[model samples]
Target: MAPDQTNSADVLIAPAPGPGALRHRLEEAILGDIASGRLAPGTALPPSRTLADALGISRWVVTEAYGHLVGKGVLEARTGSATRVAAVAPVAVPDGAARRVAPAPRLERAPDRATHDLAPGVPDLRHVPRDAWLRAAREALAGATNQDLGAQPPAGHPAARAAVATHLRRSRIVSGPDDAVVLTRGAADGMSRIAAALATAGHTHLLVEDPSWAALRDAAAAAGLTPVPVPVDDAGISPGRLRAEAARTGARAALLTPAHQFPLGAALPDERRAALLDWAREVDGLLIEDDYDAEFRYDRRPVPALQGLDPDRVLLLGSTSKTLAPAFGIGWMVVPQRWRAPVLDVSVRRGPAPGPATLDQLTLARFVGDGAYARYLRAARARYARRRAALLTALERELPGARIGGIAAGMHVTVDLAGVRVGPAGAGGDDAAVVDGRDGVDAAAADFAALDAAAVVREGAARDVALVDLRRYQAAPSARSTVLVVGYGNLADARLPAAIRGLRAAVEAASAEAAGAGAGAARAGPTGAAAGSVG
Candidate 1:
C-alpha cells in the first residue's frame, strides 16, 4: 500500500513557532491544533516528507514530532496506515475563555474538612425531614392535573402562590393576595429579578447594607445595578443613613435583611423599621427585604416581616433554604402591586421562569398547606435552640471578653473582637477606610485597626476549627470593629466543646503576637527611634 499524496490545500494549519528547537516547536504546534479542535479526531495528517518540504525543515523534524505525539496518545500511527488524529482528543478551550465557561462563582467558601465547621449561612442539613418530603412529593404527583404538569406562568402556580401567601400571613404577619407572590429558585433569584426590574425602570443604583450577604449584592450587580453601601451599626442598617444615602446616590431601590440581618444578626427595631418605610414612601423607592432564617429565634418571639408595615413599598423575600432545606429550591417574593408587572416582564425576558420544577413547587404547596411545614419548623427550632445554647455556653467559657452581636434569632452569632484586647489598651481605636464592591477587601486591613481577624481565621484553620471573618461579607468595610460570624447550625453538639477550645487557643495565640508587636512599636517611638531619643 502506498501513502496517500499530501495535498497542499489540505495541509494542517500549524501555528508559527517561536524560540524553540524545530522538533519541539513542531510537536507543540501539532498538540496545539489538536487541543484547539483544528485537528479533528480521526483526521489524517500529511506525510512527514510532504510537511517537511512545505515547511522547509528536515524530514527528521516532522518524523520526530509525529513520533512524540504518538507516544502521548495524541495521534494514532499504525503500520501501513495513515497517522490520523486520535479518537479522543483534549477539549478545546480558547485563551481567556475559562472564566466565561466556569461555574457560577461561589458566594461562600467551600466547607473545610475541619472537624468543627462554623461556616455561616448554612443550615443543619442533617435534620432535613426526608420522610415528610417524600410524602409531600407523592401527594403532589398524585393530585397534579394536566395543567399543573404543564409550564406554569412566570409568576408561579396559583396554588403554590396562595399557599406561600397564607404561610407568610400566618407566620410573619405579611399580608398579601396570592397574585402578589412570585415564586423563585431562592432569595438570590428573587433579588436578581427585582434588580432587573429596577434597572429596566431606569434605576441606576441599589442601596445595600455595608456588611451584607455577598450573593444578593452580586445579584444586583449581575443585573447592571450599582450597589451603594450604607453602614450598619448594631441595630441593623440605620434609616437615617439609608435616607441620606438614597438622597445622595439617587438610588430608588434598597436590598435589606431587616428580619435578622445576615452576619451582623441585628433585627431592625420597630421604630427603625417604620422610619425605613417612611424613607421608602418619601423617596418613592423600593425596599427589598431578605427574610432569611427568621423562624429560628431562640431568645424571644421572631420579628415580624417588615413588609407587614407597608406592603406597597416593601418587597418581602423568603426561602426554604434555611427553614426546610436549600435542596428544596423553594423561595417566594411578595411583590408590591406596582412592581409585579415589571418584575414578571424581567422574569419572562430572562427565559424560563426562575424557579424549581412544577412538581417540586406543588410538593412545597402541599407541604406548607398540610401543616407539615409548621410542625417541621417547631422541631428544627427546638433542635437549633439547644445547639445555640451549647454554643453560647462554650463561647462564654472560652471567649469571655468577646462581645457577641446580632440577635439570638438566626443560626449564627457575631463575635466582636474589638473588645477583646489584641494590643495594648487605647492602641486599637484607628478606623479603617471603606471600599465599594465585595471582592478583594482585605479583612486584616478593613477590620478594626489593631486586631487581625484574618490571623484568627488562619490559626483556627490550623486547629482544625473552621471560621469565617465578618469582613468577607462587607461590600464596604466597617469602621466599628472586627467580627467573626460563627455559625453553630451545622456544628454537631458533641463537637461544640472541642471546637470552642480550639478556637480559644487560636484567639489567644494571635492576640499575644499582636500585643507583642504593639508593645515593640510603643517602646520604639513613632520614628522607629528609641523612646525619648532626639533626631
Candidate 2:
C-alpha cells in the first residue's frame, strides 16, 4: 500500500479507557487543548519520547493520558502519517465493562508497619496543598461569572485553554502557543479523546511497552483499540521491534514512554528514539508520547524530549497531575497541522466542560501565567530529589546490600532482589533461621507473590525498598519475573525512615529463609529460576 493510503490501523497503535469511568479532569485537558488549538485537528504528533521529555514524565503516563483523550474523540490517528487532533465529535463509547470502576479490595488489617508506600505508580499526595486547593475552589465559587453558571463548550473554558497553552510553553516546551493547548481533566481523558479520534479514522491495535502501565493498557482495550505489547529494555523499547510490530499489527500508532519508561525507568536513548520516529514514518503510524514523572530527577541531568527532535511526527502530551497532584487533572497536547478539524469536532461532541469552571481556569492561568508553574516544578524536583535521597538512605540503613535501579529521575525507582539475597518470602537466598519447615526453600518469591502479590509489599528479616515486583508493569502476553518498583512520591517523610527499617526487617527474614532454601536449591540443582525478568 502507498504510504498515504496506509490504514491507520495498519500500523498498530494504543487505545484508551472506558469513556464513562474517566473523570472530567481528563476531558478538561484534552478538550482544553483542542479548544485552544494547541493540537490542531489533522495535525501530526511528536513521538511519545518527545512529549515525555517536554513534560518531564515517563512516556507511559503520556500514553495513558493520550489514550483517555483518544477514547473521547479529541484526537485522530492517520495511517502512516501521524496522530492528529480531530475536528469532529468522536463516536460515543458504548457503556461497557471498561466504564465501571472496580471495587477497592477489602483492607487487610495491620501487617508489619512500613510507611514507604513505594509500591510503584502511586502518586505522592503528601505535597498536595489541600488548603491551596480549597482556597482556589472557594475563590472560584465566590467569583463565579456568568460563564461559570452555565453549560459550557466541551472544549472546556477559553481561559483554561489559554492557561494551558501558557503552561505547556513554560513547562513542557510545547510550541504553537495559539495552536498548542487543550484542557482535559487528566491524562486519561486525553487518551480517550485521542483514541476515539483515531477510531474514527479507522485506527485499531496499539503498540504499548512490554512492561507498560497497566491502567493505560486497560484504557486502550476499553477504547476498543487492540493492544500489542512491545518489549523494552533499560534503554527503552527496541525501535526495530516497534517497526516490525507495527507492520505486523497494521496499527496506526505506537504508545510509548521514552523519557523515563514506566517500571524499568529506562530512558529512551536518542538513537532508539530516532529509530522509533523513523519507524512511524516508515509505516505511516504516529507515536503517542506519554510524559510521566520527568520533573523529579534525583541523580543525573534530565533528558531532552523526543518531540523537540521531530515535532510533527509525535503527539506531545503533558499534564499538571504529576507535577501538582493527580486530581488536579490538567494536561495538554501539541498536535501537527493535519488533524485539527477532526479534533475540534471531537471536542464539540464531548459536551462542553461542565459549568465552564471559569475560576479554576483563571487561577491555573494565573499560576502558570505568573511563572509559578516553573517555580513549583523546581521545588517539586528538589523535594522529590531529597525524598529519593532519604529513601535511599533509609534503604541502606534497612535493606543494606540491595540493588537499586532507575534512581536517576522521576518519583519511582526499581529494587532488584538479585543482590540483597533476602526478601519477604525467603526467595532471595535467605539463611537457615527463618525457615517455615517446608523443605527450606527460599520463600521471597512465594512470600511476595503469595499475599495477593498485586498488593503492597512488606519487609522482613532481610528486607528491601518498598516496591511492587516488575510484573505489575507487564502489558504483554508474557509475564515478567521478579523486580520491585518503589515509589517515593507517595511515601511520607515522617514515615520513610521506619518504612525502610521495616523493609529491612522483612528482607532479613525472607533472606534468611531464602538462604536456607538456596542451600537447599544448590544442594539440588540450578533450576531455581529467578529474577532479571522484565514483565
Candidate 3:
C-alpha cells in the first residue's frame, strides 16, 4: 500500500475466519459486511491505524486491505476523503450452489484415450521449457510498443520472419529473412498454403511419399491437387521410384518430410536428397520440405534441409509444433522468390492462414533470438535420447526378432515382422501362449514371426496399448510383413516395458491362432492338403 492510503471509519470489527493472508481475510470480511448489509452503502471503513490498534495487527496490513478493496470498487478512497463502501457490493457465489444446467446431447464424441499412448508423431511433452518460454514472453511484452498490438501483416510479424530466417540459416542453411520466409500456423498450415500456391502456379498433380504424414496428403487434396504416392524405403523417399512416379503422373510438385520421415522416421540419405532435388529441377517441379523435427536426430550428423541445396525448386516448411509445442501454432515457409508474391496473395485472401496472435510471434522471435530456443532443443534432445534408448532396450529384450528401423532418430521406430504371416486360428492355442514360450514354442522362431499386424493392433488396444497399424502409413503394401510403428515419445520410460509386454502378448496370440489353424489343417490329412493347394 502507498503511504498516503488509509481506511476512514472510527471503529472497525473483524469478521469470520477464511483462507489466505490477514490482508485477504480483512478484505473478504469487509466485502461480506457490505454484502450482508451490516455495512451499508457509503459506510466508511475504520482508519488503518485505528483498526490496526483495535485488531492487534499491523497498520500496513490494514492499509493494504483497504487499498485492495478500493481497487475492487468494494470500497472508495480519495485524497483527504473517508474510505467508504461503493454504491454496490459483489456477492460471493457459494460453493456447490452454482446453478446447474443439463449438459447438451453429444454430437461428435471424442475417442477413448489410451492408457499407454504409443501413437506416433507426438514428442515427449513432459520436458517443455515453460520457464524459458515465460521469460521470452515477458521480454517480448516489455519491449513491445503500441504498434506491436495493432493489426499485423498477413505474412506475419517482420521481426518473427527475420528471427526464423536467422534460425533457418544456422539450421537448414536457407536464405534471407527479407521476403523469403512467411509465418504460418504450423507445418500443416504451411503445406496448405504451398498446395494452394502450387495450384495457382498451374501444378495439378503432386508427388508424395508412400506412407507419408496423412496431413500432407489431406492438405494437397484440400488444395484440389491429386497426390500421387511415391514409395519410400529405409533410404527415405526412393529417388528412382519418386522420379518414376513423377514422370508417370506428370506431377510438378512433391511434398516431403526429408529430414525425418513421419511414422517411418527415415532421414533421406544425401544421395536420395540430391536425386530428389535433381528431379525437381528437371521437371521444373516444386519441393515442399516439411522439416518438422529435424533437430531431434539421435544418431549421425544432422542432415541439412533439402531446400538449402535448391531453394528455387524447394519450399521449406517448419514449425514450433514438433519442437516447442503444437499449441504455439507458429510456423514458417521459405519460398522461392518467384512464388512469394502469389503465396502471400493467397495467404492474405485464402483461408487457414496464420492465426497465431501478434504477441506470440513477438515472443517466439524473442525466444529464438535470445538462444532460449537452442537451449530448450538441447535439453529436449538429451531427454528424448534417453527415452529412445530405454524403448530400444525393452524392445530388444522382449520382442527380440522384430527388425527395428528409423531408430537412429525421431520418436518412433519401425518394427518390421520380417515376412511372418498370421496363421489361421484352428491350429493354435493362443498367440500369447506361443510368444510366452509355452507349448514348446520359441518366440523368436519362424512360427512366431508371421503374426497378423491388424490382430496385434486390435489385441494391443484391448490390452491397453495404443497400437497404430503400420500399413496405415504405407501408400501401398510392399514385401515386408506386418510392420508396427511404435511411438515411444508419449509413453513414459517405466510404462514402455509394460506396453511392449502387452504388444508381445498380442503378437503371440496372433501366432498361436495361426499355429492352431495349421495343426487343424494337417490333421485333416491329404484331402486337406489337396484342398489348400489352390491356384
Candidate 4:
C-alpha cells in the first residue's frame, strides 16, 4: 500500500460481513499483518469475541481468522499464554520464490507413465513379452555356468558378444564379427575406453560438438583430453572447422553422434558425413560414433549407420539407453582390428568390467535372438510416433508459433519461444497480480528470494503443458524469451490434455500474480509515490 501525498504505505482490504465475507477478510488481514510484521510473532492477538466487538466485525469472523492462524501455528491460542506464532521459522510460501525449484521440482515426478514412451532411446517394453522373459530367467538359472557373479567379467558374456555380432552384421550390415567386443557399462563405458585409448595415442585434445551431450564434454575432460568445441550446425560440424581444430590441437579422436545428434537434434547429412569420414582417414584419427538412439526414427526413413561406411576409422558405439532400459546397462564398443588390443588394454587398465550382468545378457540375447527385439523396435516406433504427434499437437494449440527444433527422431524435442513473453513467476503464479504497474517485485524483494536461479538450466527435463516459466534449456542471458525442451517419454496420452491445462493455469496465475505485485509495490514505494514494479 502506497500513501497518496501523506507518505504513508498501508493497505487494508476488509470486506463487509454479509455471510462468509467477513470471515475471509479477517483471516486475510490477520495473515497479512502477521506476514508484514504489523502484528509481531510473539504479540498476543485480541481474544476472538472481544476483538470482534471492537472491530465491529462478527465475533465468529474474528474467531475464525484466529482459528485459522492458530491452525497454521501462527497463533498459539494456548490454554494460558496468549496466541503466539509457532517456534518454527517462517516456511516457504506456496509456489512462491522462497526456495529453489530446479531440475527435479520443475520436472513432473510421476513415474510409470506413458504407453509408447518414444521420446528417444526408450525401447518398446511391449516387446518384453513377460512370459518369454520369465522362461529365459528360469533357463539362465538352471544353466548357470561356473562364472563368478561376485565381480563382473572383464570381457562381456561370450554369448552376448556373439549375439551382438550376429545382430550387427544382419541389422546394421557390418562386416565380420569374429573379433573382440569389450563391453564395459554402456556407450558411456565405450566413451571411457576411447578416452583412455586417445590419451595413450599421444593426442592431448579431443574435438567436440558445440551443442553435444553434456556427458561427452565431461567424459573428454575426465580422460585428460582438452575438449576443443567445434560448433555444429544442421549439417553437423563443418568439415573445414573439424580439420582446422584437429590440426590446431592435434586432436586424437572426435566424439560424435552422427546418425542423430544430441540436444540440437541434427541428423548428419550426406556431404558432411562423407567429409567427416574423409577427415578421419586423412588424419588417421579416430571417430567415436554414438549410435545410441538411432533406431526410433519417426518423420524420415532410418538413416544408415555411419560405422558401415568406414569401419576402421569409426568405432561404432551402441547402448541400451533407449532400446531396453537404462537400468539394464547393456552397451558395446566395436573397435577396428589394430585398435582392438589397445581398446582392451585401456579397459583393463581402467579395470575392464562388463556391464549387463551375465543373467541379463542371457535374457537380452534370448529377447534379441528370438526376433522379439525387432518386434519391440517396431512397437516402440509406433508408440513414439503417437507421443511425438501429441507433443506437436499440444504445442500447435497452446504455444502456437513456437519453433519446434530437432530431428523428428528421439525421445525429446525443443521449442524456441523467442517471440513469446514469460516472466519469473511462471504462468500459474499470482504474485504479479498485486503489482501497480511500475516495474518490479517489491513483495519478493522486501522479504526474500533464494539464490538467483537465473543462472541455472530449467524446464528441459520433462514435457509439461504449463510452460510459461520454462527457460531452462534456452541459451543463457540472451532473454531470448523462454524455450522448453520437452521429453514426451513420461506422459500418458490421456494425461497430456490435463498437463496442457495445468500449463495454462500456471501461466494465467503467473500473470495475475505479476499484476498484483506490481500494484502492491506501487502502493508502497519511493517515499509513498506510485513506484511499484513487478517482474
Candidate 5:
C-alpha cells in the first residue's frame, strides 16, 4: 500500500488482554507498526475516541498507551496537533539487514591518524568546484517535476544520456545518444554488465591485462566470467600475447586500459591499438576500453578512446570518478548495436544502472552542457600537473637512482625497484618469479624488492605516511614485483618532500637489517655444523 494510503486506524487490532496486560499489548502493537513502517514518521495517529470505539477498549487505555509511547520516545505529541511517530524512532530491523545504507565513496581517504597519503587513485577532493556544482544542483532541483521522481525507463534519464553523448563526441570523438549510451554506477559496474551480456551470449572467458587493476578481474568473476590474464608491456597489453590467450581460452572479450594503463600508465601505441582491434575483429570478440583517468594527460594531448576507433567491436567504459569526484555515482558505456538488447536487458533489471540519485543525474547533465565540467577539468589538470612535478622532484632528491616511470599520465607513478637490494645477501638466488610464465625474473630478487617496499610502507605507516606497494595491484600472487605504485594525487606539495624523506630512511633501515642478517649467517656458517661427521 502507498505510504499516504495506509490508515493508522486500519492497522490497529482489538486485543483480549488478561490480568491488567492491556497496556502491554497496545505498546507491542504500536512498536510493531513503527518497525514495519506502517506508522511512518510524521504520520498522525488516530484520535483516542475513534480508536477506542473501533477497538472496543477504554479511551483511557488507548490514551494511556499513547502517553506511555510518548514517554518512551516512540511517539511525540505537540500542544495542538495529533501524536505521531517520532522521526528518530528505532526500527526493529531483521538481523544483518541495515535500516540505513552507509555511504562509501569510490575514492579512498587516508585514515584519521595518517599524516601523509600516497595511495594511488584517490583524487584531491579540494579540486571540486563547489560553487559551480551547487549552482548546477540547484538548477536541477528547481526544474524537477513530480513525474521526474517517478519510475524512470530502464535505459536512463534522457537528459543525462543526451548530455553524455554530447560530452563524448566533443571530448573523446565518440558519438551516440539514447540507444548508444548505457549508464552504469562506475567502471566496475559497467564491466559487470558487459560481462553478464557476454556470458548470456555464451562467451565465458575475458582477457584482462596482467598486473592490471584488480577490480576488472573481480567484476568479471562476479559476472560468472573467467578472467585470463594477458601479459602487458611498455606499449600496453601485448597484442600478440592477448591473441594467443584468447585462442587458447576461447575468450570473446578483452578488457584493456589503452588510454592510460592502470599502475603501468602506458598509452597503447598506434600500431598495438590497430593490432588489438584487428584481433578483436578476427575473433568476432569485444574490447572493453576503460577510459579512466584519460583526461589528465600531462605529457601530451590525450589519446583518442579505443571505442572511437571501432565502436562496433569496442565497448567504452568511462566514469566521473576520476574526472569529477568518486562520490557521484555517474558513469556511461557506449554500447554497440549488436549487443544493445542484451546489455540493456541486464542493466534495466538491475534497476537504474549505478542507481544514481535523480538530482545527481540532472545536475551532471547541466554541468556537462554548460562547460563547467571542462573548466573544472582544465583547472584540475593544472593542479595535478603541479602535484606530479612535486612528487617526482621529491623522489629524485630523496632516493636517487630509483627508476620511476608511467608518469606521463594518470594520478600515480610506478617506481621500479629492480636495482634495489632489499633482502639478506644470502637470500639472493638464481630463481625469479616469472609473470605470465614469461619473464624469468629472480624470485629472490622480487622478494627483496617486496621486502624493501614493505619496510618502507611499514615505516611510512608508523610515521603516518600512507603508501602502498605496487604488488597490491597485481591480480595474481606472482604476477609482478620490484615496484611501488606511488599515488601523488592525495598529497600536498609541502608534504611530498617529508614523506619521500621518511620513505628513504625506511629503505636504509631495511638495507641495514638485511646486511646484518647476511653477516650473522656468514659468522654462523662454519660453527653451527659438527666438523664433518660425514653422515
Candidate 6:
C-alpha cells in the first residue's frame, strides 16, 4: 500500500487481486474501498498506469475498471484533472435491507454544498454585477440626504418606487403610477403582506397552483388562509379549473406564476389570461402575480405581466432574487389602488416594515434608472442561455428518453422519468396512471409500478448531484410520474455533461429498482403482500 505519486500528499492503497477476471477484481476492490470510506468522496486515485505497475497487473485492467466506475458515476474525470472519487456516494446498506425514503427537499434552504446542485430556484451567483452595484451604492450614499437615512414610508422611498414603476412599464408592460409600487424585502415578504390583506378582507380560502413553488403556500398558511390547489397544465393554469376550484372552496384570492409557471414552466396564453381575468372579476377575487424570473426568458420576448391586463385585480410581485442576487433583499408589489391601504396597514401592524435599508433601495433605484440594470440583464441572459444550452445538450446525450418540460424559459426544467418505458410494465404504457385533468395527465391510470421519487433523489445525491423531486411541490399526490425539477442556474457549463451523466445513472438505477419491485409484488401472494396498494 503506497501513496499515489501524482498528488504526493494523497495516499492510495493498492487493492489485492481476487478470484475473478483482473478487471472485475480491480473494479470490485475499488468499489469496496470507496464503500468502506478508504477512498473518500473527492479523493484522488493513482493514475491507472501507476496503480497497474504497483499491483503487478496490466495497465488495461486498471483503465477498464476506472472507466466502468466513471460510467456508474462512482468517479469523475476531467480533461485536465486527475480521476477522483465522486463528490457524492451512496450510503452502504446491509444485504437484504430495504431502501428508506428520503425526506422531501425544501425550496428556501440553500443547496447542499455539492459538486453539482440541480435544486430549483437557485440563481447563478457567480455573475452578479459587482462593479455596477458598487457604483450605484457609492452614488446613492454620496447623494443621500438626512431624510433618506430616517424612518421611511411603508410604501418605500418615492425615488425607488418611481424607478421600479418605470422599469416595470418598460420591461414587463406593467403600467402603474409610482404610488402603486410597494417595496418589500423580496417576493416572500411581499406575499406575506398580500396574504394578510386577503385574510383581513374576510377571505379564508386562497386558490393556488398545484405543484407550485412551496414558499407561497407557506405564506398563505401563515396568514391563516387555507390554500386550495388548482391543477396546472401545459397552457398554464386552466381558467375553467380555477373557476371551479374557487367556486367550490369559496377562495377569493389566487397566486400565480403566469409569466412562466414555476417548476413545470408553462407560459399562460392570451386566451387563458382573459378567461382568468374574467373569473377574477366575476368573483371579485384578488390575484397575486409573482414575476420571479421574467427577465431571463431566452426563447422569445418575455410574456407581458398578467397585472398589465387589469391592474385593479392583479397585485404584481417582482424581485431581484433571480436577475441580481437574493442577498440584495429588494422586491416590489404593484398593488391595486383599492387594496393599497389594507396591505400597508398589514405591514404597519406587523411592526416596522421588514424591507431593505433605505440606502439599498435607493441604490437599486439608481441602478435601474441609470441603464446599468438593462446592460446587466443583457449579459446575464446570454450567460444563462449558454448554460441552459449545455444542460439540454447533456440531457439529450445522457437521457434520450427523458421528457423535458419548462425548457423554453426559467432557471429549471422538469424531467419526467415516468414517461420513459423501462420494461414490459414500464411507465406511459396502456396501464399508465394519470391524474384526472391535472397537468393534462392521468393521475390514477398507471398500471405500472410507481417509481419512487425518493429513490431517484437519493441516487442523485449519492453522486453529489442535488435534485428536487417534483412531488415535493404537490399539495396532494396527483400523479405517478417521478418528475424532477432540475435547475441549471447554479451549475457551471463545463460541469453539465458530467452532472447529467451522473443523473442518468441515478434514473437507470431507480428504474431497475422499480421494475424489480413490481415483479416481486406480482409474485407475492395476498398474504405476503403489503396492506396498501398505491396506484
Report the number of the highest-TM-score candidate. Answer: 6
Q: Estimate each model's TM-score.
A: 0.71, 0.66, 0.72, 0.64, 0.72, 0.74
Residues 1-535, candidate 3: write the lDDT tens digits. Answer: 2222323433345633435677867766776666556677777777787676445467898899888877777778889967777766565623211211112444575443475778777766545666678898999999999988888788888898888899889866776555698888888888888788888888889888888788878988898889899877777888888778877888878888888887777877788888888887888778888887888877765678888787898898889887866768888899898889988888888543354788899999999999988888887777778878888887776666567878477678888754322223322334323332334343324343345677778888888888887878776765544778888766655456677777777776666665566555554445655444654
Worst 10 residues of 6 by lDDT: 94-103
Report how far off residue 514 is in candidate 1 (Å).
2.7
Ranking by TM-score: 6, 5, 3, 1, 2, 4
Of candidates 6 and 2, the better by TM-score: 6
TM-score of 5: 0.72
Q: What's the TM for model 3? A: 0.72
Question: Which 10 successive residues of model 1 have the least lDDT summed?
Answer: 432-441
Clashes of each: 0, 157, 18, 47, 6, 13
The ten-residue window of minimal lDDT in model 5 covers 94-103
The CA lDDT of each predicted structure is 0.78, 0.61, 0.73, 0.61, 0.73, 0.78
Off by over 4 Å in 2: 1-114, 131-144, 354-358, 423-466, 477-480, 511-535
**Model 4 TM-score (2 dp):** 0.64
Tell me how far the alpha carbon of residue 269 in candidate 5 is from the true structure, in angstroms, after superposition.
0.4
Query: Comparing 3 and 4 by lDDT, which wins?
Result: 3
Which 10-residue window in model 2 sums to the lowest lDDT?
A: 7-16
Least accurate stretch of 10 residues (summed lDDT) in model 3?
94-103
| Candidate 4 residue lDDT tens string, 98-130 | 221111343444454332232333443323345
Evaluated against the true structure, the overall lDDT of model 1 is: 0.78
Whole-model alpha-carbon lDDT for candidate 5: 0.73
